[model samples]
Target: MIVIRTPGRLSVRLQPRVLAVGTVCLLLTLAVGVLAVGHGEYPMSPTDVLRTLTGGGSPAEEFIVTQLRLPRLATGLAVGTALGLAGAVFQSLVRNPLGSPDVLGFTQGSATGALVVVAVGGGSAVLAGAAALGGIVTGLLIYLIAWRRGVHGYRLVLVGIGVSAILTGVNGYLMTRVPLMSASRAMLWLTGSLDGRGWSDAVPLLAALAVLMPALLACAPALRMTELGDDAASGLGVRVQRTRMLLLAGAVLLVALSAAAAGPVPFVALTAPHLARRLTRSPGVTLLPAAVIGALITVLADQVALRALPGQLPVGVVTGVIGGGYLVWLLATERRAGRL
Candidate 1:
């Protein structure tokens, strides 16, 4: 007699391929991060940095890497992961490749909220919370206004673009009202900087990751069902509208938290998912893989901004340049395929 048995397990199961890709990315990022530690203005050898990392270096070397570089690296990792995952979720939820908080005005709304708090001289924590609320509110408003016969992806995107433009104007106008020194600082924040970031900045970002990452992971099964269209998803007993709302809220929270921590580092949310899809050849945007790629991009870009440039360049500048090129290439490729 032959018996078929089901294995009982409470362990997390990851695809062997996905695990392999993730491992490669993690290793690459670590190697690049180590290289980055050696390329700053006051250069330290990789050996010295490694020793400092392992807690056996001189005081100055320890101060440079552990105190300065480590915090910046940590911030990059957290913020990039947040943006990338947020982008993947938004894109999958809306079923549009271009759907990202940065493009859809969510980050713009967050920026406006943070700017308001800054203008009013509020604390960073307050700014972060307000920014999150503002992002959610803006996304909801866009969804509501774009809801005609039903929510069309193109219509939602257009409405979001309009909202983003208005928010950009408001951000610019608000900056004009602040004093010059404060305005300069605000401008740097808008452009996104990891300079002078410390353990303090990591706290809120870590908190957001702790809260939202699991929520997103939990919703993955529902989101997977959602890809089958609302009627089909409803047939499968998924609460379609509720699932969308939850996903949107999670995405907004992730983007807002990252923006609050790093001040709107652009395009990670827009480009990372697409890059992941291409890399994995996955039928859809894979959130975890995208987040890993985004973290790598941000950390490496920050390193370039810090070391390769003649002077300090904000991380956003590097991202914008690379992301813009990617966008152009995507458009060109789509046009060639008659899909644009």
Candidate 2:
């Protein structure tokens, strides 16, 4: 740990490996973004993509890059980053890898909300809002149900699993009650499509991040402290419950926002932080690194969905397949270590 201190005696510790991992992940994300932006039905070279982005390409290239693909990429980046950040904070706060919003049923809540909108004849424009509301409500419910004096990691995890299973059933029931067409729409959204997404979809997610990320940074120091058990954190002058609540609140909002934008693309939330941790070899949370990996995985998965298959597939499909495999591997590894 390298500590930098100011004249006022405030110090920040920097981990070199974490910094290096973040940088590498960021570069990879950008490279994949370029690739995703350049290749489509009307493929452009990387140079054309760069030139178009920088205001130097022809009108057609600009149309394809700017109007066609950029917004989708932007939305993907925002959703991935949101999930990654949320996952890191949630896992860190709960001290459990299975504590992600997806596993905890927050994403199912979001899906239920969007399904409600579909059932009510609402359009895609309102689906994100409904999803966000549902996720928030579900988060509050989880907190209340899990709170006993204060929330414990293990108890919260157990309660969240139960809530998730219930929400899964609810989502299935809601799907059956809707009309066939509406149910189809709901199914696509539940599968987490980025199809036809535009600037409007990207803006709200970016704005939410703008407001919420600083709060995450502010909570970081305390978040690390909270990792050292409640007793130790409290001994170190940390307000354990307060810190936990703040972290949970921030994470929930992030999960809600991402689900709103991208229809709860699975496994990004659950896998990105763990991948970041392995790359960084860091003990605590690698929030920034996780965010980068999240963006990378999302954009890369979307690319695979678009180009590697017979037809374009929903981004969620690719993520779900990849994330499912990663989860199996993780569970096996943990089981062998007697930690499962």
Candidate 3:
């Protein structure tokens, strides 16, 4: 740990392995991003893509790269980064591998909110607003319901799982009650497509991340200290409950904004942080590395979904398949280690 202290303010510590892993992941994300931009139906060469981005290409090339592809690419990166950071915070808080927005009912709650708006003929903005509202409400509900004297990690996970099941059922019922066209729209949204996304979709997510990520990072030292146990953390002068609440709030906001932008893309949050941890060999979560990995996975998954199938499938479908397999493997590994 490399601690840098200013005279009056709090100190920031950097780990060398985390920095190295983050750099590698960032490079990989850039490579995947370039590939994603260059491999579409109207494929452009890497040189052409770069030229277009740098304002040196012709009208059609510029249109394809800037107007058509860049927005989707930007949305994917922002959504992935938000999800990964949120997931890292939640998993660290709960001290469980399975603790994520998707598994903990927050995603389902957001989906339910959006589906309700869509079913009632709301437009994109309204739907996004509703989704964020629903996620925040659900997160609060889970936190309150799981609290006895205070929240326990296992209890919180269990409550979230139960709440998630209920929300899933509610979403399904709402789908059945809506008009066929509306239902189709809802289904497509639920599957989490990046199709036809523009700056309208991408910008809000980017803005949200810009605000929330720094707050999450600011809470990082408290988060790490809290992992040493609440009593120890308190003894070390960290305000344990306040720190947890602040971290939880940051995590929820990130999840809400990401879900609003991309309709709850599955498992990126759940999988990316763990992968980052492994890569860095870090005892605690590596937020920057996790964010980079998430962006790479999302961009790569979107690329595969677009090209690997007869029709363009939703990005969530590809991630769901991959994440399902990862989930099974995780379960097996945990069982072998007597952690399950």
Best by TM-score: 2
- On lDDT, the candidate that comes out on top is 2
- In model 3, the clashing pairs are none
lDDT of 2 at 267: 87
Per-residue CA lDDT of model 1 for 196-297, tens digit only, reads 778777777878888888888788878888888888988999888777777777788788778877888988888888777665655665878888878887
Ranking by TM-score: 2, 3, 1
Considering summed lDDT, which 10 consecutive residues are worst modelled in model 1? Answer: 1-10
Q: What is the TM-score of candidate 1?
A: 0.85
Q: Sort by lDDT, best first.
A: 2, 3, 1
Model 1 local distance difference test score: 0.80
Q: Give me the runs in candidate 3 sitting further than 4 Å from their true place.
A: 1-13, 323-340
**Ten residues in sequence with the least summed lDDT for candidate 3:** 331-340
Off by over 4 Å in 2: 4-10, 323-340
Model 3 lDDT tens row, 4-64: 9999998877888888888887888788787788877788888888878889999988888
lDDT for model 2 comes to 0.87
